[model samples]
Target: MGAVSKEPTRFTVEANASGAARYALGDRADFADVERGLIARFDEIKNERGETVLDASTFSFIRQGEDAPAGVDASLWRQSQLVIQLGLYKVVDHLFQVRGNGANLTIVDAPEGLVVIDCMEGVEMAAQAMRLFREHVNDKPVVAVIYTHTHFDHYGGVKAVVDEADVESGEVALVGPGTVESFNKYALGENVIVGNAMSRRASYTFEALIPHGVSGAVTQGIGPGGGSHFTTTYIAPNDSITATGETRTFGGWEFEFLYAPDTEAPEEMHIWIPAINAVTCAENANHTMHNIQTLRGARTRDARNFARYLDETLVRWGDRVEVHFGPHTWPVWGNANVVAFLESQRDLYKYMHDQTLRLANQGYHPIEIAEMVQLPDAIGKKWFNRYYHGSLHHNVRAVFAKELGTWDGDPASIWPLPPAENARRYVSLLGRDAILAEGTRAISEGDYRWAVQILHHLVFADPADAQAKELQADAYEQLGYQQEAPQWRGIFLTAAQELREGAATEGGLNTASSETILAMPMDQLFDFAAIHVVGERAADVDLRIGIVVNDTDERWTAWVRDGVMNARPQESQNVQATITGPKQAVVAVLLDPSRAGDLVSSGVLTIDGDESVLASYGSVLEDFDPHFNLVTP
Candidate 1:
């Protein structure tokens, strides 16, 4: 036969059922908490053009009280049922939240007006969420906006709720963790260097192209499936919480911030509202086990730091925190329950960190360590600590990588052949017929992981081999069906889709915004330009350029030599060219040198000396192809 069928195989069905049995699926307390305090529900949320931004009805296929279909993990299906509860909920006497929009938009009643925490992922979603809040809850003016972290979902919708003029005029305070420079550096510059590669990978991680149904995406672990497509906007923060125990009174509410860096994000903080006995741990603590290293890719989070922050939160405010909410998932009520929740989450990460290091000390490789470590039942059995977002398998590997780097101490394995060449050699050595037979047999034996690995070489060796592609896709689908973590599920399923169909034609999540780019500091902007320079193209190019920003009164010297670009503050003697202009015009010409003539002619830029230097440098800059291939060579 060509391959196993597209439908969930008997092996997949049994695997999913067995996984579901491990959880207390019949316990309906989580369901009660999800539906509690619902003030009103939106029929659906849409953008200006009437395109749907979010529609809970789309997930109606997931029956509330029924067992999960074979295509989805049973535990995940139950979580999705709770996630699809879309509405404005009253968290307490003064706090309200808008859910089912990827990130939670919380509104807190302050003395002057409303204090908003987080603004969803984009303009439309935040706008719709704010509209619902105004319609159902209090319609007070928003006096302050607080961003819990640097992630887009936490603060990208800034413009939807607050005006830039107001922030500039000091009419509203925009508060964030760390200094303004640090926030801007991470928020705007973190991904600009390797954005294209990360974006393409994110398509698989978030199931960006997967349809919402029983057989497709169900949830993104923290919330419903399908990433947003609205306009993502940003505004720089006016006030910074630089240290833990930093206090800022926004509209009469005493907000205590815990500056948590390098946890879920590079710059993040948790909010403790003392007057209300409520705390929002930002994205640090959530309903599910959060990513120690996100599937899409980022610097590995310090699991020790993650556990430390949770423990600190518990020690500082465990007795006083009556209710706990976050940017994602439902809140935990009751001080005792909240404390217990924090302890479990804290222990979960601590165990992962300690155990992984223990095994590493015993001379185990990351792969071997991943297979060895297991969560103890005391914390592992809790619903909050379940592997809905992050799993023990990948997380243990992340901890290993964090401590011991990528190398496994084998010099022979260190310098390996490129993927395509290696795959070709493997196929040639094994023989195509033997590899295919083994793959099929592995699939028949419910060894989808092994099947994918063996068949992957065949597909990579010969991209047009339809038989290999189909067999690999079948294996991936079975693996996808059995994943409890949605990120793993998304990756496996999207891989299967790519194998069966082809690489995605369009790009994935793009975080670069005009506001963000413009806000980039001069040094960072030059750093961004350096990464864009192609080494081979710039090898023969030699130029020293001087730059002056009139508005910012900044001076810099940049030069290209020996296939690399370098820059420093202050002007250099004997520079070939000096370009003087406002920061915007200078940035535009630097990004796209073809616009130099128009800008100079329009009096936006003043070019002195050899004008051709700009052209010479620009020629070496390369624009990234967003839709790069992933599964295939």
Candidate 2:
């Protein structure tokens, strides 16, 4: 569609994509026959302002009818075509899924009313998904909403399908495992500290910054990429599913939930509908490999536990599972196919973990292990097992980082110089011309990895170097064009764009969204506030402030010591100042110091001792610029 790259495409990439397509042809049945029964396709979803939330037409540039473009991988293009097929598809009897509407929203027909699982992302998309669901299927009020996990994609659009009034009046039951706590912690907590970094990195991870085309963003590897631009909202769950083998019949449908926490998400679970002989694997077993530690930073997932959970799914519900679906991809039919899918997924994680550990035991570092570990035929050869979302390189290192820390136990590697310093030193030692000469040679020889590494040092050493930056961007473009994983391509391309043009003017989640701020517990709020306290600024200042919220009787003591801020539930014994206020007032002042005037004026705030102690403590708190430079700084 765009000016395609002239660089030679690798034979391995073509072979890999061809192999994947052939495997799919052999192993998969007719997916289109299942799609034909869809009631309707609502591709155009718009917001109140008439802005497209999930534009199905954005991906129309890459037509399914056309052959794979020169720069794009054929298998990935095929997956892209599958992901972009926006419609309501019938999974089985009484079960329907509105796929390609951002996230897959599955509608289950119950006797009393309709039950919906996984509410896309925003009100716009969710409402459209619900509308699509109602059009093909029978129109019934949503009696219950089931969230398989704590992720926002599974539950954020709750307000769209059912009213809060219904949920409040007990007409609708909001169900999930660890939904509220997990949502608050991951979605809201400490977002102010790391939100921008995560958002920027996620933009790359999901190809949000790139346009959708053959040479640009194709698919997210799990789904299509047009749903990135949307408002994020969360609706807390009322009914919690705590443990595995938990069975609950809502409106006459018996549903069993299996808790699989710390697998794909921090708090996640899989669902089994015994009545229909169907199972929802949540985000656990998707079309693509799920991330352990996402490119957007998160706590490392336990690979061992992840593998075990998949095995547990097989042992618990494999025999009865005739149809299996997830929040991302198409449904898998037939018991044998479902078993193979689950088993391959199970072994995929197990092999990645075991092999990484085996290599780590032999004193191989993360980089070495990542390069060395390879999936066997049973796991890697299958089309479903292809690394679209997750790859061997990153996942292998993730496993290593989990079992062995980043240290690598090498004394020489312990204290490496920072990037800028090291880059400058390298440039000075080797000479800029010499470095550029070698990088230029690598680029010509199609050794892009080496070219990127060398050119990166030259650019960082002198950000004003036009030739170095240009060459690096070129190298990144070529690598991006060749990458099978969409996220890796997105990251490389975004980096190149930033180098060529400039950093993005706007992007990132609102850390202080009204709902997110209100739902936060006082303790979690305090923990987030602690992160804002600049360690360098508080290094020499020993300030202790005891907070007493008269409204809630919640007491907290926050102190700065050794350049770090620490907070505990109990009040300090020896406090410099005791600040007493209502819970709302205290929270307001804690979040925004400017609100202190309003609280003080209303007689809602009072200081017992030296107010300077509180003032000094507040002064150390730094506001991070969310728009900080990424590639350069």
Candidate 3:
């Protein structure tokens, strides 16, 4: 049977209305800045197959100059309107930005050539952005590309803006925060391990499958949506800015780099332009509160570092800089406005960090701290510091997790039963009908959070319980409707949708970029291989394998013993199997052992040992399921 959905509850409508009344919805400054210095709007962007990658017309449902609908938060609706104003805008002299294509591409018209900062999320969007720039602005060749951070959205479309041949020939320089190895470690390595799980979670956060309408995805907090369906490419940065205050001249423009490690990204930096009196904070300081820990999951960011970096930026150029822009959101023009913006952002993180730790020291649990702590009106009331992307609730929890860990000083919670087992126990104790009755009562009382919590056990206890799923989904929908943060809303709504329709069988965004995989170092590749070995399956197997990469002149000995796989540099004597090939061929075999014979027959790989050993090793390696159930057991 098909799932049934519910409309916004009366209580949810009243809550949203009350929340909307608190914000100055009539404010025009943000709107003015969003549409300021607009050159021309992009009509459409298409990939090679004539598929529309990005089209502003798709978001026509978001009617500008209108009040928030019943299904959306008022504040988030405002952000959605601003982000959906898709066009190439002039930020300041010699600076242009193409906004609303996943990430904004900042262009600098330099004396030598155009210097581009961040090239959207995919090649098609990047190409369209550059095309818009050329059509409305200038058409000078791109002499340099600056990657502000290690995020894929920041540098994925590198090939579209500049030629790899030019980069190789030194005609175009690729500048970034850290060395190529460091970039690969954070960008490629971090995601490749447990990538399927992260991608599954990210689908909810980004609302990848959600339709665009008042009842669906409005904005991706910082932008209209995630990257369009196009080729996501990456090119390692050739030039690394390793230190703070390090200066590099690109396209006749001098840029001072402030290496900000472990803030928004593990490898991230902010650029200071002396000539333009402008600074690009990368993803550090945006129009909204940034994530201390993203919902999609990664290493927890240092809130203290986030604050310190902003403070450093403010102290270093607060008075001098006339404008401040970022990869996401509109620019803050004028010295006073920029300074105020920096101070607010700096305080935003610092306050959250200090307060979260303060509560932690006082022995309050992370959840308790999140509920008790509230931002001062001076900081929270500001439009720039509003919870559009990151919320105080989650950031506070993230800060606590980073410092105090997830234990919360409770013995009972330390080694609790797993979710499904715990749910079954609860069902045995309370009975399913009683739990459902309580959940329905909570929903009727406008306690959606409590309703979802109680219904959670029922759903887990019996996945086929339609009443429990419906009640939980209804509660989730109401909660989603009231979230000011787009990500929070997306998570809740996506969960509700999945609970109603069952989890999607197809995978989310395919982040396994071939270029990124190829750029990965040997250690990372070995590490990835180790993760694929199923411990239980390998318990009885013991094997020694030698891998020799001809192109890189690298040798490694991989041994599987004691239900685990370990690899070290250099070969060991008397290996059971030895595989010699180029890095590409070796990588292909490692990723898909079934293709080993084909690669060997095609002369791409030479195996000089027991061939059956390869099969034994492959037998233990398990491929991760990309479409694993998230909202279900």
Q: Estimate each model's TM-score.
A: 0.96, 0.90, 0.97
Global CA lDDT of candidate 3, please? 0.86
Of 2 and 3, the candidate ahead on lDDT is: 3
lDDT of 3 by residue, 51-147 (tens): 8777777678788888888878889988888888888999988999998666999999988889999998888888888988998888899989999
Q: Could you give candidate 1's per-residue lDDT for residues 1-633 as a string of tens digits?
A: 013227889999899888888988878989999988999887577778877777777678878899999988988888888888877899988988988667999999887788999998888878888888888766889999999988878887889999999998999999988899999888877666556677777778887867767767778878885645577788989999989998988887898989889888899998999888999888778889888887777778889988899889998899899999988889999999899888888899999999999989988888898899889899888888887788889999899888889897668779999989999999999999999999999999999999999998999899999999989988998898888888888888888888888877864577666666777888888887888899999999999999999999998999999899998989888799999999999888777888999998998899999999998988999887777777789
Worst 10 residues of 3 by lDDT: 1-10
Please write out the lDDT profile of model 2 over residues 1-633, one tens digit for every residue. 134323434643454456446555433343463364576776677787877777778778768556566667666776676777777878888888887654788899888788899887777778878887776678887889988876656666778888887877877888877756664576556343465566667777777766777667788877775674455566667687878998888779999988888888777789999989999888788777777777766677888887898899899988889989888878888899999998988888999999989888888888988888878877887667786778779988898888778787789889999999999999999999999999999987778899999988898898888888888887887777777788888888777777776677765343344555555677777776777888888889997878998877889987788788777889777988888987777877776766676678789898778777766777888776655666674
Residue 519 error, candidate 1, Å: 2.7
For all candidates in order, the CA lDDT equals 0.85, 0.76, 0.86
Clashing pairs in 2: none
Model 1: what TM-score?
0.96
Worst 10 residues of 2 by lDDT: 1-10
Candidate 2 structure lDDT:
0.76
